[model samples]
Target: MEDLAIARACAEFADDKKAENIRILDLRGLSPVIDYFVLCSATSAPQLRAVRDNIEDEMKEKHGQRPLYKDGNYESQWLIIDYGNVMVHVLTPEKREYYALEELWGDAPEVALKSDEPAPEPKPRAKKVAAKKPAAKKAATKRATKKKAD
Candidate 1:
């Protein structure tokens, strides 16, 4: 599969597994080591494995591509799946927090996380209205009530 396509597929698979804070960094211009870095956080070991398995399965089934190397297991807090140009990092919250790949790759442009459905239309903004204090509101209401009573 193409490098960008591989990275996007990884993100889709990770998102499908409900991985938190999924980020795809475009490292093509900045890093010589890899073209893209797909980072995601799983809540638990089981989730981490599920996300990893999903990525592997989807990539293989759809694109006929598999990770050239897989590192770490379900026990480990972090799992790295190296697919040549694109590397996927499936990490636990702790491991993700400690590593902070987003901060580390501050220079690299992040790929937008997209879902299967079409983007929702932006909602129209309501006109801003000044809010009256409770005391003023109450006083106004009392005056209105007195006028009606009179």
Candidate 2:
């Protein structure tokens, strides 16, 4: 699979494990080494492990691809999976905020993930009912207005 496809697949795997703030950054022309970066956040250690393992397993099974190197355990609150052209970073919310990878690589354009499912239909809007003025009040206001005009 191509680098972008692999990155998107990794993102999908992370999403399956409920990873938050998942992002795929296209670094083709901006970066010298990497073509893409898949960034995601997991809430806890177990979730971090799940995100990492899911991506690894799915990539291997579906695409016959494996990370060339894996770094950092779940305890560290940050994990890196290095494929040749793409790098996946699974981090905790705190670590992700601290590192600020998106801001660091600000020049790299983000790749929008296309969902296979169709867009959800919008909910019908509730009809608004206009409040009516009392007949007595309306007549009083009309008389006051007529007096002012005279």
Q: Please provide, for model 2 over 88-119, each residue's C-alpha lDDT reduced to its tens digit, 9 standing for 90 to 100.
A: 99999999999999999897777876545322
Candidate 1: tens digits of C-alpha lDDT, residues 1-150: 567778888999999999999888877656666878999999998899899999999999989998899999888799999999899999998988898888898877777666443322323434557976889889999999999999
TM-score of 1: 0.73
> Per-residue lDDT for 150 in model 2?
100
Q: CA shift at 107, candidate 2, in angstroms?
A: 0.7
In candidate 2, the residue pairs with backbone N, CA or C atoms under 3 Å apart (3 or more residues apart, or in different chains) clash, namely none
Residue pairs with colliding backbones in model 1 are none
Name the lDDT of candidate 2: 0.87
- Output the lDDT of residue 149, model 1: 100
